[model samples]
Target chain A: MSTDSVTVHGYSTSGNCHKVRLVLEQVGRPYQWIEVDSPNGATRTAAYLAKNPNGKVPMLERADGAVLTESNAIICWLAEGTPMMPTDAWQRAQALSWLFFEQYSHEPYVAVARFVRGWTPIDSPRRADLPRLIERGEQALAVMERHLGRHKWFTGPGYGVADVALFAYTHCAADGGFDLGKFPAVEGWLARVGRTPHFVPMPLPHDDVRTLLAQH
Target chain B: MSTDSVTVHGYSTSGNCHKVRLVLEQVGRPYQWIEVDSPNGATRTAAYLAKNPNGKVPMLERADGAVLTESNAIICWLAEGTPMMPTDAWQRAQALSWLFFEQYSHEPYVAVARFVRGWTPIDSPRRADLPRLIERGEQALAVMERHLGRHKWFTGPGYGVADVALFAYTHCAADGGFDLGKFPAVEGWLARVGRTPHFVPMPLPHDDVRTLLAQH
Candidate 1:
């Protein structure tokens, strides 16, 4: 086992998992990817649960057997000593703040809406949550619009981890029924993030999920 | 205005706000506290929204007028360069992993349960969310229990910001209808956190809220 490479257990279509791959590709880190069927209960198995008590994906395991969980935390650790994370204390704090905001305020609404829409059965009772999710998701987008209006990036002076974390879900928020055109500044920022060097997009979902996403 | 100290604007009974204060006190830092009525409409006012467009309490403002939002972010920043925050890169990453888990997996369910039960009207529709919140909150506590059964603390071999972050909501989880007695390991860890140096408890809620908490 080479300690120089890490292994990531993740579901490819998941934005949270995809962010780790994006960061690894951006920074040219050596790693192996093991696709977990997240929506199909791969993450819920006893073996997986033993490794991550929370039973979530995008888990990173070093060759030396040390494991790290949480996509943002994994990327941040991979970005350490790299320009992807700010060197200044206060700037680092702001970046971290955006990260927390992305997970708490943004993902719970935006990403979950996308999941319920694209992944669940078309008539799943979860569809009832769509209206509230979209409402709350738009509020998060407005907050991003306000910030992007004055500042170009969530990470200090650059397109960095916060951008990666937010982009994972925000880029595909339309699948969740969000109208991105309403926030011109956020739309502009999204394009800018896409244009960054070594940028990689999340893989498309299967045809069934894609069709569901397009239907509504 | 002197830039020597930071001021925290927060609701007194909120666990998120109290974590910031606990970190500051533990670090022996000079800071000012401003109370905000979060359950009311105070966080949504034009003045409050100007500083924080997200319209949340537990905002940290430096004397220079620079403001930071997000409870975990504020406490991590305050704990930086102190024993409260680990210096080693890998250890810091582990600590951060716990911080993210506390917010994403834990707080939304645990803290919101408490808010719904204790602060909302007896017949408020939000009370309907308590059962689901408590179920999810128990999963989080179980994860903590599994960890605490093996490790002394969440912050990488010591009591640190991760401890403070998890302690915020976990200590008062009963108000959310969680049975901490099921997690003996977690209960022991909470006691250890309370015994830490310069530890201070969260302020109690108003009489009406307290009465509401005890009724059901």
Candidate 2:
């Protein structure tokens, strides 16, 4: 990485964090990655909290000490003035709508389910929420399926930050117990996203965690 | 409203919808409000779904037929080049981080608890989720409190969309059984938001719903 390259603090296994890495790669931006193991309490340290009071992973820090969190916001900043972001104001707003929808509608259900299954102990009370999470996650996937039926990308006319944002959790939905077979259009879109130039898949969960998720 | 003004479709009592109205009023923009009774199913109609497949209200329609949904996204577009938005790219990213945090970390807990208290029947099974929701909502509030202890506004320098986005549910957190009195800084921040020029309070819930929420 160049001396002035942006620095990203993230956890490799987190879809939220991975989205930033995906964008940086796709846009050919040089950046340094510092792994912050959020699930294991690394983000709670005073040093980490000093940088991000919110204590979430996927924080981007500039050389001048300016910091930006929220995976989609960082991606938007990185993709600005590139084809990865739309030029028209209205289309940009539409792209943002999808980004918001992904966080509010999709990630809460899907990503949380994956975390509950893989990261938490088998007897944890959060596992009880699985059924509801799966049901709600299906609804979110159906919305994406309906959108993809008519449009190839969430951002008007091409793949962009919205697509990257949604794809991060969605391509891994099966790990959350969501069946992609139910939404052919979404499946096709996921393939399209994977085929993007410089695209990198989210790192796989550890073997023991994968075993736990499978058993669950 | 002027002939060229945008039209906003929203439910009066919804914090998400009210955020849009608050921004438009604060910015002195002329816009028509079409009350869509989202709680009573207006937003779920085929006609409404045609405009927004997500079937949520607070959708803005331009005179030329373009539409934008997502309250924060709408406000950003409306506040573009205005004091309500940060002109610096990094500050803009900071504002968006708060917006995403509102939707992801804050709204799901605070807003949903309020909805459950007011909109659901007294004995609804969903009421069982309130304790967990309150616990999580309080955590979200604490983050805001900490931020308020240092910064005057969520948007970098002044009252902006992030402030508007957070204020909507936060001001009414009491309706969800959250005692804002616990967080002096958050309470003060709420007052600061209210004092912004042309600020408008969210509409009160209907009498029966208010009584229901009060009992809870």
Candidates in order have lDDT scores of: 0.93, 0.90
Question: Candidate 1 on B1-216: residue-level lDDT in tens?
Answer: 122689999998899999999988888889999999988899999999999999997999998899999998898899888888999988999999999999999999999999999988999999888889989999999999999888999998889999999999999999988999999999999999999999999988899999999987
lDDT by residue (B1-216, candidate 2, tens digit) is: 223589999999999999999988887888999999899899899999988878898899999887898898988888876799998877888899999999988998999999999999999899998999999899899999998888999998788989999998999999888989999999998988888889888888999889889894
Worst 10 residues of 1 chain B by lDDT: B1-10
Superposed Cα deviation of residue A166, candidate 1 (Å): 0.7
List runs of model 1 lying over 4 Å from the truth.
A1-3, B1-3
Q: What are the chain A TM-scores for all the models, listed individually? A: 0.97, 0.97
Tens-digit per-residue lDDT, A1-216, candidate 2? 223589999999899999999988888888999988788899999999888887899999998888999999999999887889998877888999999999988999999988988999989998999999999899899899998988999998999999999988899888888889999999999999999999898988889788988884
Model 1, residue pairs in steric clash: none
Q: For residues A1-216, could you state the per-residue lDDT of candidate 1 as single tens digits?
A: 123789999999999999999989888889999999999999999999999989999999998888999999999999887779998889999999999999999999999999999999988999999999999999999999999989999998988999999999999999999999999998899899889888988999999899999996
The candidate that wins on lDDT is 1
Worst 10 residues of 2 chain B by lDDT: B1-10
TM-score list, all predictions: 0.98, 0.95
True contacts kept of each: 0.85, 0.76
